[model samples]
Target: MIKTIGFGIGLVRFANAACTSGDGLEGVCRTRRECARIGGTGSGRCVNGIAVCCVVQKYCGDVTTSNSTYFANPNFPNLYNGGTICTFTIRKLSDDICQARIDFIAFTLAQPDANGLCATDGLTITGGASTVPTICGDNAGQHIYVDFNGNSTIQLNIFTGIAANSRVWNFKVSQIGCDCPTRAPSGCLMYYTTLMGTVRSFNYGTTGNAAMTRQLANQNYGVCIAMQPGYCSINWAQTAGDLYSFTVTGDSPTAVTTGTAGTNAVIGALCTTDFVVIPNPTFTGATPGAANVDRFCGNAFQPLTTNSKPFVLTVVNDANEVGDIGNRGFSLDFTQQRCNNVPVIG
Candidate 1:
C-alpha cells in the first residue's frame, strides 16, 4: 500500500489493465508502465509481462521467548506462490541454558517435480550453537519435533517452489521442556534412526560416515544443489545420470542465483561467511577426507550408490534452524541440471 501520489488526483491508472488477473490481487500490474503507477500492498515485480506484488508472510521475525502460538505461510492452508524466499532468526529466552524446541504441528514440503530433485525449493536451518538439521521433504505429510539443544540462536531459511505443490506448515514455539499439547492424530516425530541415504542436504559443521564417504574423489566437478526430502533413492543401480561428486559453489542466494534445481545450466560460484569446514562438517560425497556427511549449500554432489555399496546409503537432512512456520514459498527449477552426475561404471 505505497502511494506516492495524492488520492483522488487526476491520475491515469495503468497498474492493471482489465484483461487477465495476476496473483489474483486487485492492484497487480503486468508491465513496467503499469508498475510505474504503483498498486497493491507488496513490492512489485514484472514476470513475463505479468506483474505480481508478492506479500511476504508477516509473522516471521527475530522471535524470542514465546509461550505457545500458531503461525504459517503467507496464505496458510492454501498453496503459496513460487519465487519466495524468507529467513527467520530466533533467539533463546532470557539467557536460558536450554534452547527452544520446535514441534512441527503440520509440515508439508513440495516433492521434486518432473525435472528431478528439487535443488532450489527447500527449508534450511542454520543453528547458532546447538545444531538442528535442515528440513526439506515431502514425506507424505509428517509431524516433526526437535530440540535445539543449547544453541544461542538459530536461523530459519525457507523458500517455496512453483505454485503447483507448495505446502502450509503449522508449528508451536516453546521452551525445551515445556508442557505442550498432545501430538497430532497421525504421529509425532519419533522416527529418530537415520539409516543409509542416497540424497541428503547439509549445512555447516556436519560430518559423514565411511559408507557415505566412499564415493568421494577428484573426478567430477561440484555443483550447487538445494535438495528437498522427496527425492530419496534406495535401490539405485549404476544409472545413466547418477554419479556422486561433491562441492559447494557459493553461499545462500548467490549459489542459486543462476542455475537452479531444474535449470539446465551451472550457477555461478559465490560463497559467504566462510568456506565450509572440512572433515568434521562431513557431508561425504564431496571433499575427500573423512566420511561424507551431507550434500548441502556449500558442498559438492557425488553419486554414492556404487556397484558394490549400491543400496547401502540413506538420505538424511542434517537438522537445524527449524523454527519458522510462516513463509510465502520457495522457487525450485531455477535451473535444470544442478550438479547432475555422469554415467557410472562398476
Candidate 2:
C-alpha cells in the first residue's frame, strides 16, 4: 500500500542490537536467543533487531470523563497496525446538557484506491442513530468540529485490515450548553483543559499539524511528548451561580532546558534551547512571529494564574534554542476546578 509505517516512539535501538547508548546493550545483542537469556523470563522475538520484551498495548473499551475533556486514537502520533479492532466510549458528565463536541485536528486512515470508499484501516464515530462517515486515508491534517446534540454517549470504533495500517489523528472534546456564544479559533490546534485532570498531545505541533501547535514533528514519535513544544489554551465557563479560577501547572523530563529569554508578564524567562511555556489572556494574545509571549519552563511552574476556561497557552522549541530536548514530552497538570458548557467546536 502507498501508506504504511507503524511509526511513533523513535526506537533508539533495534530488536537485537539496534539501540545502545554505549557498546551494545551489554546483554541484548541482536538475537532472540541472547534477548531471551537476558530478559530472564521467556523467549523473545528479534523484530528489526530489537527484542520484543515490553508489554504490548491493549486496544479496546470505555473512557469516561468528568465534564469537558480531550481524547485521541489509541496510539496516536504512531501508525495503527493490522487486524486490530478497538472501541472507545466517551461518557457524558452531569453539567453536560446531553451534548458533546469533538474537534478533530488530525485524522488519517488506509485506502487502496482513488475512490472515496475506505477499504482498509479506518475509524467511525456514532451516537444512537447518528454516525459520522467512516474516515480513512490522507485525512491527516484537518480542522473538523463535530457536535452531538441531544445525545448522551459518543463512541468510536476503529479497525485495520489483515495487512493494512494508517497514520494518526488527534482531537479535543467537551460538553456544551444548550446555547452559548462562540468565536473562531485564533490558531488551528486547540486543547481544552477541564475540571478533570491533564490532557497530553499525540505528538506536538510539527508532526501532526504545524499551524496550530507551532513546530512540526517527524512521524516516529512515541507516547513521549513532542520534542517540539507548541501552543494550547484552557476553557472556563460559568453555569448558574457556580464559578471558579484555575492555575496552570506542568512538568517536563528535567531534560528540557530553561534558557535565557525576555521576561514579559505573559511568558516567563526565555529558554530558546530549553522547552518553554508562553501564557496569554484571551482578549489579547501573543502576536504571531514575535517571541513576546510569557515563557515558563524548568521542572516546575509559578502556576500561571487564570480566572476563566480556554486560556491560550503556548509551548515552543524556539528556533534559536537547542540541546537535549529529549522526548519534548511534558505532564500538564492543574488543580481541579468546576467548569462546563465550554465549546469544543464552533
Best by lDDT: 2
- Per-model TM-score, in order, reads 0.34, 0.34
For model 2, what is the alpha-carbon lDDT of residue 164?
Answer: 46
Query: How well is each residue in 172-245 modelled by candidate 2, as lDDT tens digits?
Result: 45454545333123231333333334433222221221111211221111111111112233321211111101
**Candidate 1: minimum summed lDDT over ten consecutive residues — where?**
324-333
RMSD of 2: 19.8
Cα deviation at 345, candidate 1, in Å, is 57
Instruction: List model 1 lDDT by residue over 274-296, tens digit each.
Output: 12211222222333323433222
Each prediction's RMSD over C-alphas, in Å, is 19.7, 19.8
**CA shift of 128, model 1, Å:** 4.9
Against the unseen true structure, what C-alpha lDDT does each candidate score?
0.34, 0.38
